[model samples]
Target: MPTLALMWEAKAAPGRAGDLLAWARAQELDPSPARREHFTAPGERVLVITWWPAAYDAEVPELPDPPQELRARPVHRWRFEQV
Candidate 1:
C-alpha cells in the first residue's frame, strides 16, 4: 500500500504560541500513526503531521479542534500521497 500524510495546522492568538505548542505536543491520535511530527512557526503557528499506511483512496482520520479561545482561527488540514 502507498503511504498517506495528514497535516493539521493552527495559529494561536497573540502571545499564545507556547500554549498552543504545549497542547499540540500532548495530543494522541487513535488508530496509531506510523510516524508523526510537530512544528512551530513564527507568528504563533503550530503544525502536526501524521503518516499512515493506506491505499490511495483510503479514508483518513480527522483531527479535533483545539480550544476555541487559544486559536486565532479554525484549524487547517490537508492530506497528500508520496510522489
Candidate 2:
C-alpha cells in the first residue's frame, strides 16, 4: 500500500497567529492519519502535514478551514504520494 501526505498551510491575521495555531492544533480529523505534524513559520504561518495509508489520489480526511477572523488569507492544501 502506498502512503499519501496531506499538507495544509494558512496565514493568520495580525496578532492572531497564536489563536490560529491553537485552533489548528485543536482540530481533529475522523479516522485520523497515521502520522501528523504541526509547524509554525515566520509571518504567522501555520503548516500541518498528515501522513496516511492510501494512494495519492485517494479521498482522505483533512483539516477544515479555521474561522475567517483567525486567518489572514485562505488556506492552501496539497497531497503527495510517498516515493
Candidate 3:
C-alpha cells in the first residue's frame, strides 16, 4: 500500500504563534497516523505533516481548525503520495 502524507499549515495572529503551535501539537486524530511531525517557520507559521499507510484519496482524520482568534488566516492543507 502506498503511504500518503498530509500537510497542514497555518499562520497565527500577532503574538499568538506559541498558542497556535501548542494547539496543533496537542490535537489527537481519531485513527492516528503512522507518523506525525510539527514545525514552525518564519512569519509565525505552523506546519504539521502526518504520514499514513493508505490510498491517496482515503478518508483520513485531519486536524480541525483552531479558534478564530488564534489564526491570521484560514488554514492550508495538501495531500501527497510517496513515490
Give candidate 3 misplaced runs (Cα > 4 Å): none
Pull out the clashing pairs in model 2: none
Q: After best superposition, candidate 1 residue 39: deviation in angstroms?
A: 0.6
Q: Against the true structure, whose TM-score is highest?
A: 3
Per-residue error for 66 in candidate 1, Å, reads 0.3
Tell me, by lDDT, which candidate is best. Answer: 3
Q: Candidate 3's C-alpha lDDT?
A: 0.97
Please provide, for model 2 over 46-67, each residue's C-alpha lDDT reduced to its tens digit, 9 standing for 90 to 100: 9999999999989888999999
Please, what are the lDDT tens digits per residue for candidate 3 over residues 41-73?
999999999999999999999999999999999
Candidate 3 is scored at a TM of 0.98
TM-scores of all candidate predictions against the true structure = 0.89, 0.97, 0.98
Worst 10 residues of 1 by lDDT: 55-64
Worst 10 residues of 3 by lDDT: 23-32
TM-score of 1: 0.89
